[model samples]
Target chain A: MLGAATTPAEARAAFRGGAVRPTAGIAAGYVQCNLLSLPAADAFDFLLFAQRNPKPCPIIEVLEAGQLESEVMPGGDIRRDVPAYRVFRDGELVDEVADVSEVWRDDLVSFLIGCSFTFESALLDAGVPVAHIDQGRNVPMYRTNVPTRPAGRFSGPLVVSMRPMPAAQVADAVRITSRYPSVHGAPVHVGDPAAIGIEDISRPDFGEAVEIAEGEIPVFWGCGVTPQAAVMASKPEFAVSHAPGHMLITDLKDSDFQVP
Target chain B: MLGAATTPAEARAAFRGGAVRPTAGIAAGYVQCNLLSLPAADAFDFLLFAQRNPKPCPIIEVLEAGQLESEVMPGGDIRRDVPAYRVFRDGELVDEVADVSEVWRDDLVSFLIGCSFTFESALLDAGVPVAHIDQGRNVPMYRTNVPTRPAGRFSGPLVVSMRPMPAAQVADAVRITSRYPSVHGAPVHVGDPAAIGIEDISRPDFGEAVEIAEGEIPVFWGCGVTPQAAVMASKPEFAVSHAPGHMLITDLKDSDFQVP
Candidate 1:
C-alpha cells in the first residue's frame, strides 16, 4: 500500500519512472490535482468555462503558453509529471500514454484543477465513512439535470460524485468539506437522487456504485469530471487530461486549501 | 442619496440616461464592480492573470465574445451599462466617454471585477471608521514592491488601498471584510507602510491621501486598480476600463458575497 507518508516529489518521481497506477493514498497529506491541457486558441474559452463553473473546476494553478513548470508545484514538468494522460482529438480519446513529452507544445496551456480527493481526506479524518474506499471501488458519479452556466463554446450539465454515509453524519460531512471550497465543497444535494435527475442510485454514470447501509443517506458534491464532460461535449480540436484516479501530486498540502 | 431600495435595473437606467458620477452611493446594498474590457484575443490572458492574482482582481462576472449581458446582473447591457469608460491604446489613456456603445466590438470581452467599495460598507456597518469616506476623500492607493504572478502578457507590481482605523478595531475590520473574498479580503499588511515599500504614508500613487491619526494604524488591502495597472504595463493593443471611482452596479447584494 502506498502510505500517506510519501512526499509529492516522491510520487511524481514514481510517475516519471513508468509507475502507472491510481494516486490515492500516496502523498496523502498533499494536494492531488486534475490536469487539463489545451491549445492556446481554446485556452481562453476553457478558462472562462472553469471561471463560470467554479465549484466543479476550482483552479489551483494555470501554466500559460511558453511555461511548462507550475508556480504552485515548482520543479514539476507538465509534459511527463503525471502517471498517465488521456489524449483526445476532436473530443474522442485517441491515446492513453505514460509520457507526453513528444506531444508537448509551446502554445499549450495547462490547468491544474482542485480534486475532491483533498476534501475526502478531511472527511476520513473527521470520522465520516467513505463507502467506496471501504469497498475498494471507485466513487459513484452522476450527470445531473443542473446546467452549468455556458461560456463561449462550452455548455453542459453539472456532474457530481456521491458517497453514502449515515444520516446523522451528513451535517458533519458538510461542515468538514465546506472548508475546502477549492476541492468541490459541501454536498449539493443530501437525500433524494431523483431530485437531481439520477433516476437510480444503484447505477452510476461513472465509477462503481457503493452500498448505503440502513439509516444512511447518499450525498453528492460537484465532481472534477465535470469540466472533462464539457470538453467532450464541445469536441475541441485537441485536448489532454489526466486519466481518472491518476492525478498530478503537488507540493501544496491539503491544509493549504482550508479557509482560515 | 441613492438608497438601498434601488434595484440594479433602476441604477442601470440612470447610468444609461447619462448620469456620470461615482457609483459608490448609487447602489447602496448591491455590488458595484470595476470594469475592464479588451479584445477577445487578450481576454484569456487577462482572465488567467485574474485567476493567478485573485485577491486584487476578483472576477464578479465575465462576458465572452458574443455575449453582452452578465449572468450576475441579468438584463444589464455591457456596452453602456456603466456610466463612464476610459479607452486605452498601447498603454496610453486616449479617451474618456460616458457610453461605450459606439466603441463596442463583436470581439470585445468584458470583465466585471469586485470593488473594495462593497467591503468598505461592511466595515462601516461594523462601526469601524473608514477614514476616506468619513472625510469625503478618495481611498489612498499605492503601488507596492510586491509583484503579482505573471499570466501571459499581464504582470506588474501589487497595488494596495489604505484605510486608517483604530488599532483596536483592526481585528474586527479584518473579520468583517474576510467574509467577502470576492472583494479584496482582509488586510494584506497592517501597522507598517514602509514594510510593503510605501515611502511616504502621507503621499499615494493614486487617489487622495487621508490623515492617519496617532491611535490608528494604516491597514492595506489588495486594490482593484491592480488589474488596470497590469493592463497598462502590458500595453495591450486596445482596452476599455471604467474611470477609477466609477463602477458597474450588479444585482447581487453585499451580503450575498459573505461565505458564511
Candidate 2:
C-alpha cells in the first residue's frame, strides 16, 4: 500500500516523510484540495476574489493568520502535508519545495480550494466517459474571453477544464456534478468552445488536449487554476501553492457535499 | 397595480418617493435582500465573517467601495431603494433614515444578503403551514450555544429563526427550502431545541413566539440577523443595515436559485 493509502492521515504522513507523489487516484473516496497560501495583507483581496468568482474558486476552508491545521481537515498541516509545493515571488515561480517550513511566516494565511477530481469521480461512477483520462492525458483546459468579477487587486479571465462527452449524456453529467457545489459545482459552459472565445480546441492554454468524437460536445467546468492565474496577473509579492497535479487529500468523503 | 407592482424598479421608485413600506409580500415573485454597509476598512473582516458563516449571511451581491448599484440587481441604488435604513455607530443604533445619501461616503462597501422570506414563501406555496404566519406573529428566534466559525475581527454565537411544524411535514419543508442556498438554505437544527442550548420553547430571544402543537417540532434555520449580531459584538465604528422587516426587492425571481 505504499502508493495506495486509504485515509487522508496516512496520505499526509507519507507526504510528510517525503515518500509520496501526485495524489490523484490515492485516497479514492476522500476529498483532495488545491492549496493557496498568501500573506495576510493580500488574504482579504484573494478571499474576495474567490467570493466574487465562486465557480472557479470554490473555497473549502480558509485558515486564519499563522494557523496551519485546517478547520475541516483533522490533523492537516499546511507546511508539510502536501507532497509538493510551488513558491511564487512577484508572480514568478521561485522554487519547488517538499516542505515550506523555512519559508513559512506568521502573516501567511492559507486557503484550501475544491478540486475537480471530486466531480470527475462522480461523473465516472455515473457511466460518463472522461476523454482525457481515457487517453491517459491531462484534462484539456483553456483561457476564456469571459472575465471574472474583479476584487481589489485580483482580477483575470476565467480558466476552465474541459471534458468531452456524448451530447445525449450532457444533462445527466450536469445533474451528477451539480451535487458537488463545494467541488466546482456544475459546468459553466457546455457547447462550442468558440462561443466562449477559444480559437482552437487542439491547443489548450494549459494541460494536454483530448479528442472530441463525432456527436460529442465539449463541456467546461471552472478549474482550480483560476486563482493561480489571478495571482500571476496581480503579481503579489509572495504566495505559496500546491504544485500542479499534487494535492492535499482531506478526511472528508466526496459524498459529504451532496446536499438535499 | 399601485401596491401589486411585480418589478424591483417600481418598488424602488415607490420607496424613493416615500410611498412604499416594508418590502415583504410587496413584489410577490421577486427576490428581496437584506442590506449591510460598512466602511472600506472593515469590509474585509465582515466579508470574511459572511464567508465563514454562509448559512446566516448568504451574500447575494457585494458592491465594491463607493459603488452604489448592485451587480445582481440592475439599476438598483443602495442609498434610496430600501424603504427604511438603520445606522449603527460603535455597535449602537443611532439613526433610522429613509435615504442614506447624506451619510454615504466614498469608502463604503455594501452587501445584499438573501432573506428568509424567500424560503418561507416557498414552504407556504408547498402547502406546509408556517405557524407564525398562521398566527399573524413574527417568527421566533434564539441565541444558540453553537458558535460560528470566527473570521478576522468578527466572532459571535449563531442566531437562528424558529418555526414550529408538524413532524409529518418537516421533510417536505426541508426539501422545499433546500433549493435556495443563497437565502439561508435548510434548517440547522430540527427537533429538540434544547440540544442546541434552547432552554425555553415558549420564549424567544428575538421576534414573537408561536405555539408548538402537540405533534409539532421546533425547527431552526440560520438567520440573517447573524451578521448584525457580529457587527454588534465586534463593535465596529460604523455600519448601515436595512431596518428589520424592510428589505430591498431585486429584479431576480425567487425560483432562479432552484437547483438540481
C-alpha lDDT values of all predictions? 0.88, 0.86
Interface RMSD of 1: 1.0
Q: Please provide, for model 2 over A1-260, each residue's C-alpha lDDT reduced to its tens digit, 9 standing for 90 to 100.
A: 64545678988888988864788788887888999999988887888899889899998888888788965667867899999998999988899999998999899988899999988888999899989889988878899999999888899889999999999999998999898888899999999899999999999998898988999989999999898888888999999999877898888788887775
**Residue A122 displacement (Å), model 1:** 1.5
Model 1 agreement with the true structure over B88-196: per-residue lDDT tens digits: 8988899999998887788999888999989988888889999999989988999999999898889998999999989999999888888788898877888888899
Docking level for model 1: medium
Q: Model 2: per-residue lDDT, tens digit, B12-87?
A: 8778777546766687878888899998888878888898888999988888786888656678688888999999
Worst 10 residues of 1 chain A by lDDT: A1-10
Q: What DockQ, on C-alphas, does every prediction get?
A: 0.76, 0.58
Interface RMSD in Å per candidate, to 1 decimal? 1.0, 1.4
Ten-residue region with minimum lDDT total, candidate 2 chain A: A1-10
Candidate 1 TM-score, true structure as reference? 0.97
